[model samples]
Target chain A: MSSPLYELGEPVLRATGLSKLYARRSSDTRARLGEVAGRVLFGRPPKEIQSLRKHEFWALKDISCELHQGEALGIIGLNGSGKTTFLRILAGQILPDGGEVWINGSSAAMIDLQAGFQASASGQENIFLRAAALGFTRAQTEHRLNEIIEFSELGDAIAAPMSSYSSGMKMRLAFSVMAIVEPDVLFIDEVLAVGDFRFRQKCLARIREMRERSAFVFVSHGMGDIALFCDRVIVLHKGKIHFEGPPKEAIEIYESLDEPASAVDTPAQLTKAMGPTFTNSGALKDVAHFWCDESGAPVTNIAFSDNVHLSLEFTSTVDIKRLILGVPVWNLNAHYTTGLSTQLASEELSVRTGERLKFLLEIRGGIANPGTLKSMMTILDGAEFLYRNPNPDLVIENAGHPTWGVVTIPHQWNLIERQ
Target chain B: MTEKLLNTRKERAKGVRIYRPDSRIRQNGLQAVISISREIRNFRSHITTLFTSDFRKGYRGTVLGIFWNFVLPMVPISVYIMLVSLRIMPRYEGLSPAVYISFNVTIWFLLTGLIRQPIQVVKSKNTEMMKTAIPLSAAIVSSFAQLCFDTFVRIALVVVIILAMQAATKWTALFIVPIILSASIFCLGLGLLLSILNVIYRDIERVITILLQYGIFLSGVIFPLASLGPLVSLSAANPFNVFISSAREAAFAGSISQPGALAAWTVVGVILFLYSAWFFYLMEYRIRGSSE
Candidate 1:
């Protein structure tokens, strides 16, 4: 999969012993004075009392990564895992306390979106300011003016102060100026966070487009995005690269949470279709069945579209008569998705003592949204509720859109838009 | 490991594209010195942006676009000079009161500007430094550059006043250049030092205003330096005094009595600069480890 596109004649970029040491600031006034005093061979001054306290932190430490020309390097980590910090260090926004970071291309960093913008300046003015901060020359900014403006879509507000802009609007202008005016190495720090879903898609596409002409150091918490966009994904933890390779494996390693499985559907109807033959002594107690995988192990993240089955083995300790059962699917958030009740056609089952019936519900594919969805089954004696149980947090993911509310009605839009 | 990295970079180089910072800076010395030139070259544009931004941030959402930038001390600078000339000049030599007032105003403008700048340089630090790779001194530099612009404007006004006075231009007028250079270095050094102090403490802002007010009157900005006698000599000890004296020597006097003023202040400025730079570099490392 990693076929080299260029001849191996030269090295474009090398991060040799690439290290970043962030010196943490401490509030030891006496210690500082002593250090200064020691350096000068003098008695330490009395610890002066200053009411200001600032501490230093290492946002990035000993990070080393190499990006070939046209290679998209994805930095995946949780918030504050130093992904953005590493990108910024590479971008040369701040100097490392120790070590050297060498890159062989023009680098631009969006460490924080619109980092240098003056809110009082108009979007047009800020475009110029931000462009220059991004290392573009006046002539270059001038050449890309139309493209930037169009992408910004700031319209009449281009002449208005950025303070008057909405957060989305500001990101719009910043993204437009930087993306339209390409750099040799573009560092994006979760820029997908700025805009709404649709605009985020557009920005992602633009980032990909820019990758053709430049390299990208993209930091994101979204595994799907990293998998889709990056050529190589690195998972960072605590200012270090924990895993480096394919995004899928990285995602599996990244999300090591034992998230629970969801259910397929709620058994809808419970009706007996047989002649009523009943031993009144018969009773079904506790219909709540714990869901497990094919290996008979308790499993989570059970897909609604999976052949994975949910089995309800109700114990019939009494001589049961005309037992009716009902099943309801409820998500982890306590929202019910779909419910099904037991149905029998023209027959009623007479259970003997200590009889246990195991009903397996099988899913064809996986659930649409395999997030935490729970399930519950209830058994009613004849038309009266003898026993019922509700098991919450049974996550069943579907092979469809994770719907907003509980019930999802199956319907199709048959009409075309009017001409 | 070296072989793998070299191989990847080798292929990358074959692609014929390189980031500006990643590549050589032409000369042999360049590859060693990170192109900090970009930081210096962007100096003017940064100030232009900051001045425009500050002018707005200082008064935005207020009904008064306030025009507060020029008006803050512009009135005191004018009114104080007039009051001083009325109170003192006629008692001294029947010299044109306008001459004393004009000179006083120009000196006050430059001195007050220098006094106000170092404290404000700190404000720029708390906001802009940690976010970008922009050096901590850059914010101070931009503010100092603005002060230079202010000094230029005041000097222009002072020149117009002298022409109106029908005074002869002196050989000492050449002294103004050295004076400005000294004042610039002095102001920048002071600004850098204060900016560092300010990041640690909040009270520097208020204290600086007090310093500026008392400094203006004591530096003989509102009154002639000669009237204060030995007190004026003490005023001359103030680096800002050299700023005024240099301007006076260039524009007003035939010759300044103090020969070594400019050289002394220049040395003081350099010392302050080096000290502040060292202090800032030390703290800069510490500040980054703290939460924003």
Candidate 2:
């Protein structure tokens, strides 16, 4: 495996001091006209224009990176984090307000897979047209025409107008044309998510092969793909390079930056909890303490096939009658596992103002897969939302069989001798 | 972890330039010119592709196909011919009304098509063009190429009208070549400037549409220049009038008029072309960013 450090060489692409500032646009025509009139009459823009200038913010600020040949760099960020802007500037589609990008080789960007396609033109014609738009000559496209058609698998549909093709077919045709061009440097932005799973896998494999020959700058929100393909990863936050390092380390930082669900108070638990707690906070009711057993001791981890008791103590500021307590479990993938509610057991509980309530719950540990299981607490009063905690203080770590998915079920395998 | 990575990479990497906001090196005018020309040269294939695709797609779905290119301008030309034949409009001296109107409208159509399409070309293709590696200049060049194709079809229609009228052909008719070239260059310059402006202030497009609508009447396309009476001087001074009338004179009368004015317009066209190109290069980034 080629680690980032092992693949070091002369940089094929370098970007420095790349900054883009966007001024706020005023939608009101009167305000725009007033500003223009003010400038014409007084030789200066009015106060509204000056204030609009203040609304400007840098979409990309001082972003600099280098990529060597045969190395793939991944950029990960949330929406509005400047990943797209950075890619565009690097691809030379958009010029930066400040800074310079030096690319030593020809670059191709698959930023939008469907760009430059004419709906009225036949699929075969669009292939040539799109190839030409990507700087390929007619002879060059003609040489690869058969290969593109075969890869797209459109067959007779190639003769039909592009408007008749499904979105996937269009994407396939676009990718096929893009795949034939062997640029020295490639910039891809979220295009790996195109087509079906098999096609996606094929595209990914092709990208891997291409990366072996050229430097690649990839932008994707999928952390798993980043870890699988990228040697180095950069995490952007609010238009700045928040972190850059190995893919494993960078993914950790990126996951941590995700905005936690509303009720999860991770910061407070980090300081308060003596052990790991998967969920925290109760929205309507404040979760004071949680214990795993009658011993009132916290349960940090549990083994498979073991029965465990979960206890939650909470206080409500408002009086709630016809109350129902619910505990919903989620796996690491955020897939819903199971939900247990007091109403299902036909149990009733009432709490008055300033009253503390304790609920004890039990779980058969073998039913849960061996991974981190987050539990959410919800307290409802006759279908009215009284208090709900998406991330509570109670967490069950089921140490069971090494399996995938939210829940585990037991079964037996048997063999019958037949003549 | 990030700090460690940065430090190790910084030590190992050579010739990796780190840029910051304050460290940008500004290019001079000469350097900018050279760089822009190089960029345009590199994307020449893209320009041609975009042009041909646009030209083909413009008439793709129509029943008449490319014939519409010849037919659309003739509608108004026919209307003006009927009006002149019925004596509703005064006819030009020593000129068939149909021939005069056809030649003038054909050139007018070419000028307006060149002036109008560029404003919407960049804006309409904003998403696709920006996503691709093609430069904005490629789209501009493509619009000009399409205009050239449209102009060719219109010119064909004008030639047919001249033949049908059995008008006398003169050697001086060759002068229309220079006039057409100069007028095209002028329109292209104005189009380039307007395209960027349209991206900045979308109202410029609407304003241009209104201007073109009124401009047809003032351009002496459907009527004779002598009929303007007191406004004849103002009409004569209009650049559109000069473009149309000069061509009509060369094609119908088989002689050149206002040679000095034609020369002046050619100079203006060159100046506009250079100034618009320089201005576009300067504000390209801002124009693109603003659209977003």
Candidate 3:
């Protein structure tokens, strides 16, 4: 995520031990009234005395980070890990209870994309309204109006009231306006989770183009996006910075901190018959799932160039015929990455009841897309699923090339001069 | 954070903003007033833009559009004049009943508008202010601008009536300026205070609505409060009563009763405005946080 344009040492944003505390108990109206009454009767006692008396816990505690120009910083964490609290403090939307944050230039937080839009106003009017909210002058907004309209691809719909717009169209207009504004520092919280695939790609490209002038602080649960955008990543755990450095190593630590993936109890709907003729005769249970390298030792992490041997162990409850194994890989966002199945295999196999079978599906090279990937093992007889083993996620550590999409295909290019 | 970096010319050029636990800006009354003035000035464009949109949105689908500003007040004025002419209500003294009722009713509308608009704006805009960087000052000012537009039109209508009646326009009538200014400042102060409290207490808006419904009768918009006996002194102490009645007397007859009381309340109004604005600024973040 680094580039030659990055001013490596010129930090535009700096935070020193920023922390925020939230009251565990709600500060009810009665308590607030009593506090006011006490102040009026006894006069001002002291600062922090009342707050200290209340039950409070720090949502963020002594966390610090710095960002230089043209660099993007990624923050990733589980729920309640303080990622959002840290981002809010840095964005200046919420003040930290302790410590200091200094930004050398203006910053804009795209926390809620449609925050200021007027439902009854037309898209054309709303663009100006949103521009004003962003502190843009009329002249500046006018200058960029045509480009924004062209980028949004709203065309005739721009004249229609925003209430009539589909949510995707609204997101397009909002993102186009913000992306065009180009603040000195940008704080984005999961805005890319919206829009279609094409629009998201356009937004990412726009952000990459804006990197020359802006530094980004991005918060997302998607590891692929984190690896794609951030030059440095901070993994927050329990209100503290548990890991910080390169995206790859930080992601590794973040994944390791989570409880290892365990077997999900098979839902009843999946075990139901797909057709009237099909009956629930047998079920499969996952015993072991892991990936290994050429040495045949269980490898918890796999690199892109390494030969991948996906080993799975399962036992069937009844005798099954013409059963084929299906291995489906999915990214953390539940996006299908790739499908590896024995459906295309020429040979079919049969298994007896209570027989424990181990199957290994080997790939010449590892998955190109990098992130923590989950795999489901499905034993299919034609179209009906006899057994589905979906537990124990497969983690892909690294990719050889920076690419977009679920899986990158092996390809090459050759230069030739035509006579 | 070093002092050099805090306010240095180079840092200013880069727009360095530093926030700490005690980073709240400490300002006295005069400084707070100055800061608020500067913020209003810097956001004047936002004020105008929001004002134009809000004003237009008020009458967007109507046939008459801006004329409703005049139409709304005329209905009340006409009804009161008819009642007075029909001998159903006591006549307004010292001026033509039509002129007096129309003029006083216009002023009363202005007062009611000043009292009512702020709470509505702050409530409707609670989401916008909390979710975005739009300053509360800009929203307040823009809503004030709409009221200003309406008041300007109503005053124009009053002037036309005065010209048609050929009443002697006295030079001393200029006293109405201070009367309106003081009243506006006082209502704005009270409105702002209530708007902040209204975010935490949902009943404040309803209470204000009920109070305004009874305010016109108590203020002697149609007839003198002298008939009410004990309510005369009671109305004198009421700022709305003092300002409206004083303004009416000044504009129609060139003299205001209880000038000393009006002056005292004017001073009070100025102090209230300053304190309320300062209080609003201090509680701004807290109010926004609680608005959700």
Candidate 4:
């Protein structure tokens, strides 16, 4: 959706060499005391004059970007990568430690959707309250009242107190009010996934319409939404820009970055495994977990379009009657992409003591959503989980896929002459 | 957020806002005055909304609604009047014992209300400050307006009592106007400073609350500190005593006991108000940082 106004090259928002410094928690008390003493003696603190100080680390360093009219810029990064900090600086919530931000026209931020709604007040009264909080006059807010009510789809419920409304209804009201008050520049931070599926689609369409008039700085972790809304993307890593280019290429780079070791979904206490020593009913220890090709040779990497198999080996200490193996794969975002289970495949087997059992699970269609995926194996007896690998063993590597979602299906597209 | 109030040549030419490191709003006292005036003028509507909403929200579910503001102050004044009628308290300021105690307790409530309510007002609006760019001055002014409204209601009740008791009226009673204004400005200045500090160290709130619980006894409002002999000079030095004692002397008697102190403390009030406003302007960023 690249309109001609996007080619006008008129920069509406610009940031250059922005940085923020935060004192370490251990030294924060001493620094705060010094700051208070300085303020008491001399009007302003010396820290404001000389920004850099010891025991302080940069949250964002030397980040520069420019957004033109009718363009949506996406910022993608893992948690604690300074994405929110950067957005707050741009939105004028906090001043930067270094560098400057220039806005050519009016701006608004959707950093927090439900920022200033009074619970004791009725929804109709709160519209005026929220509008005043946004620095709009009562007359101006009144002009858009009907439209906001309609967009929120809260016909009779608008007269009810805000405290009585459910959380989803509150979110609907907040999103509708913010959407109606259009500004020249809009800074949105991961607020798109609001309400249910149908309402989320409505919000996306509304955002698309607003893109024609306002320049946007969008931050989100969902790659699909980024590809849909942003014309270009910036990938940040550890308070630095790792890559900046088209959305597809930026997504690839973001996926290829190594997942942090202490990522979510790992168990709290990991049981160290020396090797496979399964008591069948007591526990199942994994010796090796890997991916193999059609010829059954272990491979470190697998392509999304290739045929592959996942193999696991274990040695049993006792005879097992009914065993179930379940493997679940999780993407870097901790989103469960896909799973495979032996019970679903209807394969029943028994293992005896001192027998080394090898289970081979064939991938009929290769796993999609290219990235390094983490998979953990679970051994169950009916509804009871006998053993679970505390640490994910199988790491699936699929790099540089063009598609943008978690699953891919083969289909054909043809144009029929029915019309 | 004060950067938006800079509203200079750049703002007039289509609202091009610029944010940079250490963008101070004031370079001098005149600039600080100008910036505050500009902020007040620009956000007057926001100030009105916030004030009305605050007044309404305080007594939302009650049957009496805003009348509570009128009746709540009467409870304490009624207790003081009962004590005066019971002969437990002696006459103060050479007037009728009941009238004197009524005026003293009413003025006392006005003094404490101005100085104490601001910490609660500004602290509760901390969330509103973080989420919106509504100028901090607007919130403070709204708080000042609500307190003024409550004070006016109580002052009206005191005026009625003065008429009903048929107390001797003096031409010097007009002096109470400036005395009340001086007290308001002085307490506002003190309140503004305490509210900001309370955000940084909440201990200020707990300590101020405890001190205020006993402040009435020590401020010469209910008891005549001068008759205590030893506390005479201390009472004269206290601004709370200066304002309340000056108002009593001017209203009932035609002359003031300590006119020079009243005039000097009025100047101090002006200077304190100016200094505290400037300090609040400069420490805006630090206050916002610590509030979260």
Candidate 5:
């Protein structure tokens, strides 16, 4: 319940039960009139007037959290999960319908990178303009003007009008200016995805340095970035906090939302018939059960460079001749990385009516990056798919190096001496 | 007990400070005014930057540059003079045609420009205004400053024409300062209201454009208000007529005829500005939401 970083400092920013509701667009004339009349008479929106219209939905509801100094809190959610709304409310750009938010010191938000730039003005002129918009005085901006220019690395191009600059140059200028200001609290929303990889890495390093002095609230959909940067994480779902905990567990919860039980047909019936470990496709050929083994013993977790054995039990109601069983492995993002098929190995077999088949497949866990790997057992009669494991739930936890992609190939590096 | 624990925790953390949310609810008119004034004061430098940049950029591409600011108002003056000289339009008997028409046209342009600039500015900069935390009043102030610069040029043009026409200078001509200030305040009050309204209702801009087209003729900018015959009372009662006639009387006749009505309008203008500003703050969130 308590995080090490959370206890390092006091909460610099806090929100209690913050909520916002937006009314549906009114189509009825009388309801629109009533809304206007209520505004004119009471100077505030009437609570009952919304009921006269179609309906209203909460964009955010009863959300509460505290951000401590020297800590970074990551907000992860699917689109339309009120992540942006929460950031805007915290940034003081929008007012919440219910509850309140408080901050301790001066804050700046890069919610939109090009929010205050004048297209007709030069980059140097826009730096001053945007700084002024952020409430910095002319003298203060002048003091840091050179540092900003050097950091942006625009060089002579800074003298040209912003309309001529590329989008990457614009983001660099915006990010440099904001980072140089060094406000006590900073809000960044998915701005790191822009520009090339090198600049993105530079920006990330800059933000990490900033975190040592200031609190940061970062909203990103990239789980890798979240894992690297966040000290704590919160998962938002349907305008509410679905989960709040460590980064790894929160990522698991976020990924699990994509795997709906309905994605696999009759999951409850299958779990009841074949125990909770099995997932049945209820197709022409049903995968009634599955399990994994390491060195002939049943296991769920395996170390790096170790071999894993997978066993799948399937049955077909109709006669399936020349059946081929295949295992397709996927990474955390559901991207297929590798597969093994009986047909490729010249191990095809012929089956009769109501025949049950058991297939054993061996997989190398050393090739996969350190994370979760999912496997789907598929039964194919040549090109036609007879059945597939409706729920691709056979997860293998890999204990490998934190590499970039799903697969890691073996290679060697040597140092050469130069004259 | 929890409060004590929080305080102790805060004290242990050397430089960290705890923040608590302040309640934001419906505020009275006085509270709204105080908050708005505070916000404007806080963003004073931002307003100045916006004004200076806008002024420079307005004339950046033109060959004539800032001279166009003076030349723009002269087009109407030249057309009116040609009409009177060619015997197409009747002239005032007591006042010189050039001085009367030039003075009235200059003041009319200032008023109309002040009113129109804010609405145009808010529409054009809608994206920046919504995305940044910059105060909305800053944009209004910037537009007003730009128009004031143009007004000064027009005023100087009127002065030069009066001297060329050999009109006698009066000691009371200095009263033009206060008269012009009052007119600007009135323009600002109406401009702020219309700018906020234009964001909510797109049709307001079109309606104001059509109204301004006919308004110039009715306000006696081209001729004397006394010559309107059956429409004389309505023309004389118009606020624009009152401001223009006072400006002319100060410039040529050397005295104002109706000081009471002028003072009343100025007071009304000040009151209108305060109320409009409060209304703007009240609808700030709604305006931002609806625009996006």
Candidate 6:
């Protein structure tokens, strides 16, 4: 392990002032174009470049990190926080606009599990193609062919075209071939969560073996893995590195700011806390519910990249004052990222008795790696901590019950065997 | 975390020295050649892989795999020849219908192959090629490798057809080289522009598809360039036409040493290649960034 480190120099990979920008949703631009086009046929409407209105947001901004040989750099961020983007840039799969990614040795980036594989070719054929793409020659690949194939456990499927295999099997084949090349810098992006548990364990062991020679940059939401394998962890907010340090410390800060109280366990109780924005059915009297006999299982497996719909029913007797409506996610171990609230300075809380408040929460990728998560609903008065438990109370009160944390982060897996 | 990991690289190389974005790597001649040559050498092992992969993919999931590349265009082409020679030729020129039609359409297919495929070959493979620091030239060369294989198959068919015509194409017919060069350079020039545009608007692909369709008809595929006359000749002077005409000249009459036209085309091809290559290098950073 130490031998590989010395060959790769003081640091294997260095990124300075790296930034990546992705175009925003083009729907708004399309909608505007439609209006302009419609007016063009009818009479006249002001016209502008449709693409100009296209939103552009930087996924990684001024991201700087030095990954030394044989060390693990763990990256954690909210969904869309650009963990994979950084890895790809380092791999030379993409270039950065603001700065440079200088590396001392060859690098293999595993941004997409399926990136280099030749889809129409067999797993065996793809292995050669993929390895060659990473800078290996025929002699080298021929020598390692058996080793790479054995690790994939593709069995007889190695002879079949890759399209015939399941996505997991394809991902496994891709990862194994790239790993065979022994690049100085290896980038693994949340691939550990792809297959079943047994397979994940096998792949992790292979990754550990590879670590004997290569420095790895890993991205995942699960803090446990960071704590277990990472030499250091960098936490990102939006697109900037908000915190960087030891895995233990970074995960601590991340979880502390990430987890919030749940709104479900006491949904029946939330009808009573009577914070703000409570109407007959929902705030501003805009939500509808079809309950009684028709109850869908509330999507309870919530992760970071889910849109949460929180609903509360209550009967307000007196006019409620400044009420704050919010749902917070609390980690299985109780840490908070931040608290989001539904307090519009424009909308006043003017609900009388017997009303309800409902809102939706949209979650993005890269927030958390992956694992068990929980959330809570709070209806507070003035400045207070109110964890709603379904206890019936009148006016500023009613029983609260847990609604749903239906969104889940997929834990895809890949397994490898020793050759 | 320790402060040792955060050090930056320096700018040491003067003009023309091989650059290391990571300044620690000495900018010496041997290092650059050894590495870039390794990159170039890596493509040799890949030629077989790319050729086989391309040959396989061109007909994947469908029956008659590699045979399609050899025979797919031959059918409609043969049909068009039969239609025009037996029916339309007596109305135009006084040549043998089958001989003229076969000679003309075969040349058309070769030229169309160059134009249709090479457009933005770089961008189509952007996701795969951009993954490594392999020289940008490597991607274009690989696509050309695929094209060369396809061209070889077509040439075999052309030779058999030309021999059957009993028309011995003389050495002057070698204009096929310059014509292919014209089509290649022009397409490469256009390919670079479109590869850049593709990162922004994928619709350019649809637009190119349309251009090739119209271009195929305009370049005298179904009919002879003679019917279009001086206007057509001027159009034939167009790079794509020169590519096809050069081939047709070699395979058909074998009278192709058009020094003036070849010289003129050589100038144009060189200028276009340089302009496109320079533009690509100038925008290299931006284009790579834009793809993601």
Per-candidate TM-score against the hidden true structure: 0.71, 0.77, 0.79, 0.85, 0.77, 0.67
Residue-wise C-alpha lDDT for candidate 6, range A175-268, written one tens digit per residue: 7776675777788888776556777788888888888888889898776666667888889877889998877667756654533235223533
Which candidate order results from sorting by TM-score in descending order? Answer: 4, 3, 2, 5, 1, 6
Ranking by lDDT: 4, 3, 5, 2, 1, 6
Worst 10 residues of 5 chain B by lDDT: B16-25
Fnat of the models, one by one? 0.14, 0.33, 0.42, 0.47, 0.29, 0.22
For candidate 6, what's the RMSD? 13.4
Clashes of each: 63, 4, 0, 0, 0, 58
In the range A143-167, model 1's lDDT, one tens digit per residue, is: 8888888877778999998889999
* Model 5 quality (TM-score): 0.77
Candidate 4, residue A380: Cα displacement in angstroms equals 10
- Candidates ranked, most accurate by DockQ first: 4, 3, 2, 5, 6, 1
For residues A1-419, what per-residue lDDT tens digits would candidate 2 score against the true structure? 13663456777888877876655553332334334433322323222222335556788888888888778899998778899989988887776656778776677898888987889889988988888888788888899999999988889999999999999999999999999878778998988886899988988888877877878899998766787788899999889999988887776676556443442445445333322323323324457434366476777666556666767787777767878877766654445567878887656777787887777777765776555556666667768765554543333343422244556777677888868
Give candidate 4 misplaced runs (Cα > 4 Å). Answer: A1-5, A23-37, A48-57, A258-263, A266-278, A281-289, A293-303, A312-361, A364-366, A371-392, A397-406, A411-418, B1-14
In angstroms, the error of model 3 at B160 is: 3.3
Candidate 3 TM-score versus the reference? 0.79
What is the C-alpha local distance difference test score of candidate 1?
0.59
lDDT of 3 by residue, A63-109 (tens): 98899888889998877788877887787766566788989888998
List model 1 lDDT by residue over B25-101, tens digit each: 12232321222334556554555555556656656676666565445534554565567555644522233555555
- Which pairs in model 4 have colliding backbones? none
If you assessed candidate 2 against the hidden native complex, which CAPRI class would it receive? acceptable
Residue lDDT tens for model 4, B189-272: 777777777776677888988887777777777777876688887866888888988999888888988888899899998888
Query: Lowest-scoring 10 consecutive residues by lDDT in candidate 4 chain A?
Result: A268-277
Candidate 1 vs candidate 6: the DockQ winner is 6
Could you report the DockQ of all the candidates, in the order they appear?
0.17, 0.30, 0.37, 0.42, 0.26, 0.21
Instruction: Report the Cα lDDT for residue B64, model 4.
Output: 84
In the order shown, the candidates' Cα RMSDs to the true structure are 9.3, 9.0, 5.5, 4.8, 7.8, 13.4
Lowest lDDT 10-residue stretch of candidate 5 chain A: A271-280
What DockQ does candidate 6 have relative to the true complex?
0.21
